[model samples]
Target: MGRAAAAEALTRVRKTLVSVPNLAKVMANSPALVKGWLALPGALSEGVIPAPVRERLAIATAQYNNCEYCLSAHTYIGAHVAEVDAEELERARDAESFDPHIAALLALSDAIARGRGRIDERQPKARRAAGVADAETAEVAGNLAPNLLADTDNEWPVVTPCTHN
Candidate 1:
């Protein structure tokens, strides 16, 4: 795409997200990539998972991937937007939760991120035991995609104190 398209993508991203993240700015260099990045999260938001659980999943996946940017961003979004408690946010980093269903989801997310999309057989069994259906378990990949995309290489010029204003 041309510069105009990239600029348009960046504009759309800012309008959709309400703020332009540094990663979004870098993604603007490839308009298609940035657009696709925006689309995945939008699509996943319509899935079975609750916003708070999804945010926890993102936190767990980010921690697994060692993406400081994603971890910080999701931590803030989890506590603020999703109303996840501070303790829950910290527990999520370890793929844990007081709610068993959410804990299962976070574990599944962490497994997916750690395995790089390949999970062990026992993981699904554990999730199923926790009342997670096959479908909801599958959606973990949907949540993992955007978190993984945020810093695929585990490197994104770490910025502490995620400023989301």
Candidate 2:
């Protein structure tokens, strides 16, 4: 897509998200990628995972990936938008939670983010034993993927050399 199409995509992103993030703006160079980025989170939000849990998972994924930008943004959003408490937010950084089910989810998130979506068989069994059903366990990746994307985009931004007039 050309620059105008990318601009239109970014406009759509801003309308849906209420504000355009820097990462979204950077990804807008490729209109298809920018538009596709919005779809995953929108679909995942409609799934079984709660918003707060997803925020926490984002925190965990950011931390595991060592993305300062994603970590900070998710931490703030987790606390403000999700109403996650300070202690819980800190715990999320380490993929821990007071709630076992959530902790299980966090552990799965860490595993997926750390392993790059290749978790061992025992991990799933452990998550299941901790009251995380197969579906929620599966959704952990759904929650983690966007955070990883943001993490990658922030750490190494897409560089397109400008052509001056």
RMSD of each: 5.0, 7.8
Per-residue lDDT of candidate 2, residues 10-125 (tens digit): 99998998888888887888888877789998988899998899989987777776667777778778877889998998888788999998999998888877677799889978
Scored by CA lDDT, what does every candidate get? 0.79, 0.79
What residue runs in model 2 are displaced by over 4 Å at the alpha carbon?
Answer: 149-165
- What does the lDDT read for residue 135 in candidate 2? 81
TM-score of 2: 0.87
TM-score of each prediction: 0.87, 0.87
Residue-pair clashes per candidate: 0, 0
Candidate 1 per-residue lDDT over residues 1-165, each given as its tens digit: 688988899899989988888888778888988888999888878988888898888887767666688887788788879999999988887889999888888888877777877999999789889999877877888887776444433233342432321
